[model samples]
Target: MKKEQPSWWRPWVLPVLLVLGAIAVQELMRAQQPAPFSYSEFREAVAQGKVESVLLFPTRIDGHYKVGPGENPRTFSVVRVEDPALLEELTRHGVKVSGVVPDSPWMSIGMWLLPLGLLIFVNLARRGGSTEPGGYLAVGRSKARIYAEKDIPVRFSDVAGVDEAKEELSEVISFLQTPEKFRKLGGKIPKGVLLVGPPGTGKTLLARAVAGEAKVPFFSISGSEFVEMFVGVGAARVRDLFQQAQAQAPCIIFIDELDALGRARQAGPMPHEEREQTLNQLLVELDGFDPRIGVILMAATNRPEILDPALLRAGRFDRHVLVDRPDRGGRLAILKVHARSVPLEDPADLEALAGMTVGMVGADLANVLNEAALLAVRRNKDKVGRAELEEAVERAVAGLEKRHRVLNRLERERVAHHELGHALVGLALSGAESLRKVSIIPRGIAALGYTIQVPTEDRFLMTRQELMDRIAMLLGGRVAEELVFHEVSTGAQDDLLKATDIARSMVASYGMSESLGPVTFDDGKASPFLETGPSRVRGNYSEAIARRIDDEVRHLLEAQHARVRELLGAREAVLRKAAARLLEKETLSGEELAALVAEPGSGKPLEPPARDAA
Candidate 1:
């Protein structure tokens, strides 16, 4: 850690010291001044003809009077009051009275300087005390944090899960380390490399690693920091940043969240002129910088679609490197990288854990490991075990277990049946995700029960049958509720929404609707990298086609619902037994659930109890 050097010139410190010194001098002068004499006493002295003389000013009267004939004259000051009769009495008593204006040069100077000094002090304090670039005067200066080569601890080995992105950046690192090699070949390195990916995918980390590997200075900044409320400030900052980067040749300049500064300029009445100016300056810098100078400009953003096309053109951000989420092997690699510091039990199944976390990125994997370590400590265990890791995964997916939320007997029974419905359907389906666990215990915000299904492996493609099976599995809970209780509850709200979305995507996006005939009606606005919520449907198709689309979606869901109802209806006896056992145990692993489903029960369906009798 760098020691913070003592600031010699703090803006507030000087003002404070000056004020304190002034107060001290004022106090010293007060102590040296003669005691105050009351106006009444002065009047009485005048009446007794003991007052020798008085000097009257606008504010106060300074005078001296003899205590006795031989005594020295004592000086005293009295605050002036409106006493017209006193002056006449002094005249009548034949006392000496002089009207003299007070003239203290220092007092006059202080009176003129005090308010001015106070205003200056307030302005200085508000502008900030330190000489850092965040002060009002330094707003135009770049806010980039400069890091020397040795200061960056991250290297290629420290980053994982984005191997392709790393591979792409390796060439940039080589160019930085040996620009002469590329220059000799009459080839120029890419002036800029844009790292595009979803959030938490280690885009920024990869940039740091590039600098670390090349052993060059690194300048890291966010694009939003370039733009300010002032119109031309952002443009000035862009120029200043480039100047600093050029000064430190063979350095890497990284800007995170480039979309903030480089969004496509919209044609409208109200344009963001400041942002446009800053972006134009950035473009100019990119064009002006020489590739052979080893000043590599790198940027990262999740929203690349919204970036200005000019900023992403050839010879600008010449190459675009995708830092996508890790697959199974990548996830395993990431888990290992994060697990280096965590002490794990010898038999901890990291492979299985990695498999369970299918779509997790590097940051999420690190969080999982951290959460596992925390769980181990919470359970008074020295080493993190598979159980702790598994629980952490559950917490990550479903949320923290709400063990204190007690369910009534009826609710518990309903939740048990609902979860088992999902597990049984998933297990029966050939292409469905493998059932992991089923629990009636409440977890998360509103989940009264949950059933976890882990894919056997990472799957990038799914057949139409697989998608249908997925839909069936989702609707199984509601079907199970109807079969057992003869009525469905709102517990399957999330499941229905998910099933409907999948069915709609299959029809509109995947073109699986038989009647729609492979014609895609999707607006294509959804980001491929992000797991965003369902998009609002744009009216790209006619009302007739829209009605057809809605009809197809309803038919698909109704078909899956009917299939699930039929499938669970025949297995009602097994469902009843499994639900009873789940109520007793509160939780069941995949193996236990499979065993329950395999066990042959009496070939009889349990009838719903009579509502009137109850």
Candidate 2:
């Protein structure tokens, strides 16, 4: 039979061995004092310079001198002596030496051995631990963070917009907070809820709110964090994460950007084996957890289609909540929430602002309000006014004005007419708003002059006639350039791009084009990899139909141009006067412009500035 090693000397014995060895070395290298060297006896030798070098080292085996400036340079010899006597003797002998010995042999040895010993012990421990069934490697540990209800600061009040999403998630809160209420009659609560929406639409916010309302521990992490370089690490992490969640009970696990870890597998060459394994483990964990035990798993992602089918099964991510952009009523609510903290000139005319921000998401609205407040603070104003907010909206949507690029007088004059033309036509159109101000003064990014329109009221849906009128308004700037200056400038490049996008969207997405019927041609560029829409693949529309689409767009633009010219012809004097006043004042509001346009003989401005759109 083989002899058995002592239990203490097994794999965990290195640290003990190192500590014993370090103590032994230290004892052997202790300092020892020696008889003093007499200076008088060495003075004659020093005068003759016979003592070329004098080195000092402590009296012990394996010791070193603390190297210093004052030392005999010629000879190589070390002497050990006591403290006071050694100093006196050295002075008598005319031999120089440093103050003290800095290092001992045992200290040098310990410095090198201590760290090496620790590493060796660590390695041994790791190997020994690996001998177990699951092994010591932390490959399957979950990266999700857990927070108790007390830890989560965000509540439903913190979130704005997406009332429908909020209502849908209320059930989730009810289940987690009072499970008995739901399970009383065999009503099984959803095990998982996947919040899906466009970027910045408050998906994550809603999930966090659920965690807060439930008053349970919350575990949050991004989907990307699950993936790693080692095989099966992600899977291991997934297992560990869910196991932890089960232990906590009454808890939430919020995985942001689920698309990263849960993307639909492809048919081509297999990729990221570890990631797949991790996702598989996540699926298993999701199924294994008992929903009745108060463990609620909430996840968020902009792309929902890419998640694994197994993860989306009935027992997994059962409910899919659509957190879409806020509608008109939602915007008003969002405005009210944001307005609470801000000092507004007139409570922001929220209904009007919402109308102007029809397609804006929750994030965009927040940014708009923030930008407005920042502008007010910059101007040393006490509160944000409508002017500041209007400027903020323009800046947020169109970017800050690039006033640094200098334009010559003639260029400025042409830009003035360009803007004047747009304002004039918009004012004269039945459905369009009158020009509030057409300024030649340059503002934020790349604009020479801007024709700002102030609508009287918010309009949710635009009729075909109104769309045509808007198209005319868009083309007015370019048409005016061609008519008055006899040449079109690149200044209208941005205008052209905007007009083209609107026309295309109207035809392809909005189904407003008569030639295209009511069929939407837009591909809906929501996801980068998704290819379901027209953008993914070209449609079967014939080349002739494509030609007709182009012709229709051009006809729309031409009709608008004619309308602008006819309108401008009647308001030529008003156009010059407005541009001149814009140049003088630099900025004007709707009321101010109305007063100017209402001048006894001035042309009538568009309908009293309609409230902004939502």
Candidate 3:
């Protein structure tokens, strides 16, 4: 497509015309300006009887005067002289001078400059606007950051995790590189590929990787940039963006955060809204663009559910590749890729670290490595150690440690028991997470102590029994406090919160309630940019049903609480010993905690309680 050459008279021509017009107006106005004279000259004119009429000011005078008697007078202005007889002199010369009159000072810079500024502004505005209707020029231009092939150093090798997404985009890159290969195979290239995923899942990065691999011009923009305050401007921008893309064939147009622009149009007619017009224009452009010409439109959005149906239809963005969070294996690849440059001293097992970060995205894994490096430097360490990396992960997950927050002896001992309780309970349960570390050291704002559980392997599907075990583990700390001190502290607040949330999710979300049957209480309405909408709870169920849900939640918690209490009761001696040792050490490893809970003579698991007798 040939680019349109701007009119020869465009930018400079308009400003010059306006400036010349202003100068002409100024000169014409100046021609009719009043002439200035001295007070003495005015007095002479009056004495000579050549004055017609005079308008007197406090220190100035304005009137028509003549050089010869009976001649037409010319307008002139004069300052007053020090002489007190000026008025008497004028009266003596038969000049009809009026009484004193007040006039404001004029000919200020602001008075003349105001109109010039206005003219300049209007002329520039007319020239500045693009060929848009009502001439909204800059607003209608696309805000895409065009990156030449050499500018983007990110290749497919730099991208890790989301392997499937990479595979899907390979076709796009392939088509761009060798369109003939697909054309011979009777395959028309896909016009658009929509990357749908959660945030930090590397959607934008993957698009860049495609551009890098294909060696195409990358036009990156955000969806929000297309829409503006003015109507029809968005539509104009959409057209401008496509025109530019067509000009740069074999280019990638990556629209980030596309939901902001392509959100589903409201059911009612809103024809005048700028957003609606913008969406319509985008739809038209997507349909009009030819993928065969090597212009592939790629967009990313975490909230794919909210996108307009027309935007996601067969012709526009037919192929939607889900760039979901990386699994354990993918996270390992991502971590390894990010860690390639960092110097490591006794580096942690990337595989183990990856196992610990089961649901982390590629971006998150990258941050972990960067944060680990920063933490090492902060501690005056020359190289990244496993301990630093682990601490970084902890920081990433639980927030930074507040080590300076000192606790009293009694509270510290209590916290030891509380954390160990969780560890011991976790050790007993088969489905529970394996212990990583337990600390009496305060971490983050709320956690006085915490038991870090590292999973042996990532499990996507959890059975009902597994969830029940998780609930039991969460209650263990509270149960330990109740059994040992006969009262629980607020240390169990976070644990209880997690336990309650799990129990409620099981009832209201998972449809696990026997009373509620196989029906979930959640309204299942699609929420934008959130896991689920918390506001729309307790729907499709009555107040009575809601009461039952409350009962069911409380009953679940009570059952888990009872189970935890019984488990702690049987292992009371071990709990006391571990708590005591924990107070002395102020921290414990998984091995040490396991040894503390081990049987007196054997390494076998803690034996379940003997049958209760009446």
lDDT of each: 0.86, 0.72, 0.81
lDDT of 3 by residue, 1-614 (tens): 99888776665665667768978998999777786777777767777777878878777778876557675557888776577887787777777778653444564566667776776777666666754434434666777889999998999898888889899889898899989999997898778899998888888999999999999999999998988787787888888889988989989999999989988888685553789889988888887777789999999998887788888888889999988878887898898898899888854677767987877788778898899899989999989988888888988887778879988888987888888789888888776377888888877768888888887776778866778788888999999888888899988888887888888878888888887878787776555435652343457878998888889989888988888788888787888888888888877989988776674843345654332210
Which stretches of model 1 miss by more than 4 angstroms? 1-107, 110-136, 602-614
Off by over 4 Å in 3: 1-123, 131-137, 183-186, 228-233, 267-272, 346-348, 378-380, 526-536, 599-614
Candidate 2, which ten residues in sequence have the lowest lDDT sum? 605-614
Which candidate leads the pack in TM-score? Answer: 3
CA lDDT for candidate 2? 0.72
- For model 1, name the residue pairs that clash: none
The per-residue C-alpha lDDT of model 2 at residue 326 equals 81
What TM-score does prediction 1 earn? 0.80
Q: Is candidate 1 or candidate 3 better by lDDT?
A: 1
What would the per-residue lDDT of candidate 2 be over residues 482-534, giving only the tens digit for each residue? 76777898888877766766676677668877776898755544463233333
Candidate 2: residue 136 Cα off by (Å):
11
Candidate 3, pairs of clashing residues = 129-137, 130-137
| Model 2 alpha-carbon drift over 4 Å, by segment | 1-140, 269-275, 305-313, 343-358, 381-391, 401-405, 432-437, 454-460, 516-518, 523-537, 540-548, 594-614
TM-score of candidate 2 on Cα atoms, chains taken together: 0.71
